[model samples]
Target: MPVRAVVVFLNLLLLFFLGPSMAWASNGPAEPPRPALTVSVQQVDFVEMERILSATGNIRPWQDASVSVQTTGLRLKAVFADVGDVVQAGQLLAEFDDTIIRTEIDQTRAAIIQAQASLEQATQNAKRIRRLMGSGAVSQQEADQILAAEKINQAQLASAQAALLGQEQRLAYTRLLAPYDGVVSAKSAILGAVYSPGQELFHLIVQNKLQWEASVSSRHLSELETGTKAILHVGEGVVEGTVRQQSPALNEQTRQAIVYVDLVPSPLVKAGMFVRGDFKLGTREVIVLPRQALVLRDGFYYVFVLEENNRVALRKIDIGQSLPDGVEVLSGLVAGDTIVVKGARFLEDGDTVRVAQVAADTVPGMASVTASGAAFARAGQ
Candidate 1:
């Protein structure tokens, strides 16, 4: 072989072997920079939280009474009050036919007048006979008989007066009056309808006073007492109430006890309205976190906790009662734990995060993010 040809073949062989090594040396593995998320963080702590017992109930009148008629076999002449009408005590609610009652009263009065005249005549006659007997013009037995007739006439007069008074009472009964200050809830008596005694003419809610009848579990009865405060949710409004009474026995089917809470008057509340109420039993120690820190995923609750080196880890938590400011943390957390309050929804487990704001310690179990900590978050926005 020629020397030049031999040299070219050796060079080609060397190039083929060095090409793979050179490429590997120039392009080696490189680490990519981790994506950092700017977020706000809060420090959570244990708090003295209220232990509230929840229950459902209905709004009812505090003093419901059925206004009824006292007289029987009287036709309803007029109805003065209708349903939803506010009436005062002794206010006429309905009227029965007073024609017969008045007529009887008039007849009794006439009878009384006649009996009075008869009594006066008998008294005069008895006096005259007694005087004559003293002079022997009348016998003693004859005078006694005259006096007896006088006594009978006087008795008849008293009987007539009693009958007239009774008839007057019956006449008053023809007008059904409100027993108390109340709002008429129902009316069953109709005009010209003959009603018997004790028949309910109208149903009244005394003074329009309403109450919440809450059904509490029998197990929680021990925690309740008269004068305990309660909060009722009625028609998008909140009503304050006090524990007025409680049932002595539990409902056989529901295993619940009825608790009556007298409510303050509110336009939003009405009788027979189904409502929900919360009874504040007492306070208890519990871990609390801001509501924004909680994340709901697949029906589970989670929060992003700030780990060492500014890294975040997704943590599951068990939540208890919800409060006006925060929620109760049942488990899976401890005091002094840092959690992402804002911008946690866009983060995942092990994600690197830059804490924009660290909340200040203001309220128990909750800390507000510092103004400086939020600088980065604001800038990002």
Candidate 2:
């Protein structure tokens, strides 16, 4: 072969081999395509939100009284009321055996009658003594003695009258009367059972009016006051109530205080029923987002915030009161910040996402997105 042709052939062979190697070296390995996550986002904004304090407690009568006997050593003769029975003030609830009391009263009346007779006799005797003393037929000492006897009989008559009054009062105590309009909650008095003074016979709930005694944390005490409005959850219904009072001291163990809320009359409420309620403290401007937007991981709360170029940043936030519409964002968020509402659970920090919708329209399963990147566009509108 010619020398020039050989050189050209060698060069062509080297070019074929080196050309492929050089192209491979210049271009690094191909990158995998980034996964796109479909998400719905909403812009955080300041909304009119009310600060409410939630608490749980029991329903109890506004006024409860233990009815007991005032007079001692009387047998319960009859019970006019039983548990759950309604009663009125001054109405008879039970009766004690007043036979002994009546006899005592009769005896006192008889003693008064006898003392009156003696007093009248003594008066006549004193008149005669005075007449005789004026005529000098009786000695001054004898007349004075007769007049003293008359005074003694008159004092005896006064004592008898007072005794009769006490007996009469005791007789009246045998009939148990209701102190107020209330319902009988309990009964321990049995027919023919002897009872003593101060022994409870019946339990009465005044007016059947109930109050919710809720335990609230001490931190929220300053936000509550008497006459503050409250909503009580009783059974399947809600009843309006008012904050009537609160305990001055906190519980030693729980460090919580008792708040009493007087409920308006409702058939659903009764004494001893467990209830939950919320106190409406007041309204304030707050940055809020939908509950679905929040993602709870470990022990903290987080939200996926949208950034430039379809990227998301996981943000930790301090949550405040949870309302019906959304949750109050206490911190870690600002007004007009776009946050992922739906499909945030499947995301991680700094993940690239394709926003399916924005604002109210951004809700999961929604069909469209707005031009302003609204996650809750319908909500804002």
Candidate 3:
């Protein structure tokens, strides 16, 4: 009886030791320490996306021409065209004193006549020397000397004629003629005032072809291309333009590239003004999440994702530009993954979450101060 009782006691002790261990082995891994997180998760998707580049810059004339007087120290006899005048090509816009210039021209003509007479006499003398050499009336050495003298005279006559032509051309330049058919944007010369060469007399712009010259941050260069459609903000309307060029050089101050867009012919537009422009590159489909859903920590972005076991895991994500709906995730997540869209700031790693959808639809845009969190708004205040 005693041995049996001892055996019974040992059996009871073994049962007590092994039962707990069997229960522990059946449980497997321990439950994670997850926080109570409430959020709305979204599935990532791919759709058509159009990249845009926006910047502020000034408008300018495509063919801006500055007209200046080429003749120096000439008295302005009269002014024919004024500012805002639409002139045709070759039209005489202004005149300078021709009194002294005309006299110079006459003198040049007299000099030309005198040179021609000298050249003719030299030619006749040379011909006579050649005939004398053939007939042996003059020695070969003497005929050669006469021919050299005739050539010298001929060179002198040519030099004199060229000077005369130069004087005649100067007389013609005294009259300032319209360089091209353009509107007079500016007029600087005064009546009867003597102006020097290269003095600003007028400013002209070509009749058509206006340009929206904009400087954009170099970071945005990839978003723009030649022939890309752009909208130029005008006074009260938007003008359409096609990007003509994106300069490779960057501005020193702003570190931006100069972009030129040619505007369609518009009656309401003029050059030398300010404007805002936007260019569309192309479209892309990507996974987008709201700016509010992102949790920035240690120079990286993250979003809380719910796993199948009903637990939340901190998911690191690569984010791009802010969009109207949400931020585009460049990587780190795929479609059909549930991300925490709301109450993400209050959650931590290994947090447990209950997924719920909100009635209000949201997209990625700049997060408003009031929308970040109550704590953030208070700190700013």
What does candidate 1's lDDT look like per residue over 282-367, in tens digits? 79877777788899999999999887667899999999888887788889888767788878889889998776534333333333
Higher-scoring candidate on lDDT, 1 or 3: 1
Please give the RMSD to the true structure for each candidate, in Å: 8.1, 5.1, 10.3
In terms of TM-score, which candidate is stronger, 1 or 3? Answer: 1
Residues 1-381, candidate 3: write the lDDT tens digits.
Answer: 699999999999999989998998998897775548656555455655776667788878788677778777779988899887888878888888878877877877787787778778878888999777778799888888778878877887788778778877877877777778788888997888988888888787776468888888887787777898998777788889998998879989879888989989886667777778778777777777767779999999998876755467898888886677667789988865666667888888777766543332242221222222211111001
TM-scores of the models, in the order given = 0.66, 0.82, 0.63
Q: Which stretches of candidate 3 lie over 4 Å from their true place?
A: 1-39, 54-64, 80-88, 110-164, 181-187, 206-226, 233-237, 245-260, 265-276, 308-311, 353-381
How should the candidates be ordered by TM-score, best one leading?
2, 1, 3
> Any runs in candidate 1 off by more than 4 Å, and if so which?
1-44, 128-144, 252-255, 281-284, 289-381
Cα shift from native, residue 89, model 3 (Å): 3.5
TM-score, candidate 1, is 0.66
Better of 2 and 3 by lDDT: 2
Best by TM-score, which number?
Answer: 2
Q: By TM-score, is 2 or 3 better?
A: 2
Comparing 1 with 2 on TM-score, the higher-scoring candidate is 2
* TM-score for candidate 2: 0.82
List the global CA lDDT of all models: 0.84, 0.84, 0.75
Q: Clash number for every model?
A: 5, 10, 7
